[model samples]
Target chain A: MKKFAIGFYVAVTIALMIWGYYQAIYVAPDEQTMHEAQRIFYYHVPSAMVAFLFFAISLIGSIGFLSFRRNRPDWAQASDAWALAGAEVGVVFCTVVLITGPLWGRRAWGIWWTWDARLTTTLVLWLIYVSYLLLRRFAAGPQVQTLAAVLGIFGALDVPIVYMSNRWWRTQHPAPVFGGGDDSGIKDPTMLAAFGWNVLAWLAWGLLILGLRYAVERQHQKYAAQEAQEALNEVA
Target chain B: MTSALWTHLVKDLRIEWRSREAINSMLFFALLVVVLFSLAFDPRGAFSQEIAGGVLCVATMFASVSALNQAWAREIRHQVLDAQRMAPTSGAELFLAKVLANFLFVSIVQLLLAPVFLVFYNLRVEGNAWLLAVVLPLGTWALVANGTFFAALSIRTRNRELLLPLILFPIFMPALLAMVLATTSILTGDNDPTLWIKLLAGYDIIFTTVSLLLFDVVLHAE
Candidate 1:
């Protein structure tokens, strides 16, 4: 029954993804200024949004693991899984934002990259999480969870500083083009619809992958625990 | 300082003073970086002032990694970590002491490197000379405090040395930017570095507090 439900969810997510692609590529009007290259913004902005969301989720999970590690070992293990899954999936989406941003910027700004507020913060965010993943890979034993949790909190703490420092640099940064929080540059209704659909679709897709990653981590943890138990039994 | 912190700090200083190994290597490594950067970037006139801040910060960063790699190795060996835990002291004391010890060593290296750096870059402090005192130590504390914590985190890994910088540099980026920019402004007298200086101080406070709160958790992890 669970398999059937997950399979159905995956199918629906794939359908939403195709619909989103159609909305972005065919339904949205061509941008007078940037033309087809502007379409990359549909993917780029949503990916950035989703990436930040998952990273936040990962931060919360890390906190959960740290708080629960002693009394609620099982809960801690599950939280660690969510933490890893969020970071892994978040990195995947952030990578998309980094690449697609450059491609779009090359057409829109006549340059491949610049050390502007948006670009610099996103790049540093990607770097911080990538190092988080690397620490997970390199650190050994049961302590890996503990250390990675500590690093997670550290990485999250750096993001605001990264954003603030770049803004203070006083360089000529072009203002962010999309979803700048309160004052969005996106004005057209058609463009807004396409962007909305893409955000929904990409978010759905990211969550699906995040769930799978979490499940895999849980399975691995269980197997490792069982192996340890069997080794103790052998000693007995 | 608390007795435990003071004790740890004094012990680290004595051990380091005996051999001076970390200081010697850090000074030589930093000197090499300055010369090589000069060779590569050709620090001439105003350009020297422009690049010197970045060069000095990067030099300190690279030189500190070797010392940080050894920061926890001694504790983990011969069951020293376990023994330390049995003592009636919080791990935060040990962590702060280590950070303090490492901070002093790196500053000594920076002081020694100042003459060599000035000569190689043909540099002058254009902004505020007194601020160099403020900027360099704040930057060093940021690097060593985080470096010591992350170093402990990576000690049991296979490539413990390689892992330290890989983890440190990325989170260290914003601080690096502030340090480099502040130093550049001081040297070039182009921009007001008050903002960057504030940013560095804030960064140090936040990261240091978090590190202290979490140190014992890391120290006792299975």
Candidate 2:
């Protein structure tokens, strides 16, 4: 079943990618201002959405780990695995967002970087999760789990504040062009179709990657437990 | 509960008063920071007033971290924390007491540093003095609340001095940003200081409440 699922995911991903490419290139209308360069938004926005989705998952996992770890070790392990997987996958997509954002900006705004509110907040968000991963790496033993969990909660809580501060700090970047209230939106159905297809494809890709990463985490945990048991047996 | 809180607060204050280690070092460190800032840039230059708020806030934050590190290190080194843990007092009481002690220490340092900053930076406040008065305590309380909590969190970690700041600075960014903007507005005579003050107070309330509730989980973690 697992192998079948993997095959199905790969097939769907390939099919969607083919359709997305066709739609982006042949079907979508040229953006009024940015022309061809604006197409990067199709990939950039979805990556950001996926990163946020994974961070939310990590937050849930952190909360679950903290609340249940004392009474239910199995649940504790599962939560820890989920958190580790979520962070790893979240960082991957955040990196994509960081990269694609600059590429799009350079084409549209004629600059590689600006301290725009959304950009600044995204940078900070990236830094917070990076630090979260570092804390997990440096703080060893059973204590690391609880410490990382606490940090995770704090990091997630800070997201809203970061967004608010940035929004109020300054407005250097352009406002959202989609769902940006009634004033903005894509009128071209073909452009919307292209964007929609790419978003669905990227979301599926993100989940597939998350599943593989989660499996790796669980296997690693099992191996570590086995090694500890063997060491104890040898000592006895 | 009040008695327990008072006892812990007094115990911490008594220790500091006897040794004068944390407060003295923090004060001297802050002075050195100001001096370094003055040396790094010409105080009479156009940049002085514009950057002074940032400089003051950064210096205070670094010194507060040192003070907070000392606060926890002494207790951990002497096993005082372990003893306190074994005591019947609740975690919230102990946490509040520590936060209060740290808050007082940080506030005093800020008070001393403000005048020195004004003298060295060759700057004047154009806004109401009352605004400065309001910004200082709210800002200090926000810093100390998180500082105390993160200090405790990093206590058991290796290389805690490094770890505490790494964990803290990013988390404290929003509060620090608000405080800096508020201070700058007061110095530059920006017409409205209301928004920045509200941000600082809101940050203080949110973190203090969250820390109070979650501190016990941190304390009892294995």
Candidate 3:
């Protein structure tokens, strides 16, 4: 039953993705001024949204792991699993955002990038999680979870500072405002519907992967525990 | 304030005083970085004022990592970390003392480098000169505090030296921006650096408190 349900969900997610792509590429009218380049928005913005949502999930999981470690070891393990999964998935989506944004910018803005508040913050966010992933890859011992949780907290704390620090530059030539009119421009009915579908589709896909990643991490943790138990038995 | 913390600080300070190994090494590495940037960027005239801030901060960052990589190495030798775990003292104090010791060493290097920097870059403090004093130390504290905590966090990892900067640099990005911009603003007299200074202070306080609070968890991890 479980396998059937997961398979069903995967099939539905694929269908949603195809439908979303159709809506984005064909149904959504070309945006004025930039035309085809604006289509990147459907994929780029939704991926960014899903990425932020997952990173927030990672932060909550880190906190949950730390608080629950003493009283609820099993719960702590589950939380750490979520933490790792969220960070991993978030980084994947964030990488998409970083790449697609530049492609769109090169066409739309006539330049590849600018050191604006949003762009810089997104870049820093990507760097922090990439390093978080590196830490997981390189670190060892029984305390990996504990150390990762601490770094997770620190990384999340810096996001706001990173955002504001760029703002502090207060340079005479202001950062080219990418999103200055972006929020309200979505009110056009056709674009809104297409955008809505793409957002839903990407989020569904991201969550499915996140869930799979979580389950895999949990299984790995259990396998390692069993291996350690076997080693202890041999020593005994 | 605590005597235990003072004892840890004093012990580190005394040991460092004897060898001056970290100091000498950081000083030379930082000097090389300065010379390299001078050759590469050709910090000439007005442009020098703009980039010197970034160069100094990068130099400080690279030099400090060498010290930070070994911040906990001494404790790890001969099972000294295990002994610390057995003691009743708070892990936060030990973390703080290490930060302080490293901060002092980095600051001393900065102080020594200032004269050389002035000659090399032809620096003239266009804004308040006293503010550099405030800005430099605040920035140094932010770097050292996070570096020490992270050094301890990475101590058990396989690639200890390599992992420290990989993890530390990203988290250190905002402070690096504040330090570089604040220093540049002061140098150029472009605008008030009070905002960046405030941002650095807040970053220092928030990260320091969190590091202290979390050090116990990291120390007792099993």
Residue-level lDDT tens digits of model 1 in B1-222? 499999899999999989898899999999999889988988788888889999999999999999988878878779887898888889999999999999999999999999988888788887889999999999999999999998987886766888999999999999999999999998888888898899999999999999999999888888
Question: Could you give candidate 1's per-residue lDDT for residues A47-84 as a string of tens digits?
Answer: 99999999999999999999999999999999999999
lDDT accuracy of residue B205 in candidate 3: 96
- The candidate with the higher DockQ, 2 or 3, is 3
Q: How well does each candidate superpose onto the true structure, as a TM-score? A: 0.97, 0.95, 0.96
Name the DockQ score for candidate 2: 0.69
Per-residue C-alpha lDDT of model 2 across residues A91-110, encoded as one tens digit per residue: 99999999999998898888
lDDT of 3 at A47: 97
The candidate scoring highest on TM-score is 1
True contacts kept of 3: 0.92
Residue-level error in angstroms, candidate 2, position A129: 0.9
Residue B172 lDDT (model 3): 95
Q: What is the full ranking by TM-score, best candidate first?
A: 1, 3, 2
- lDDT comparison, 2 vs 3, better candidate: 3
Question: What's model 3's TM-score?
Answer: 0.96
User: How many clashes does the backbone of model 3 have?
Assistant: 0
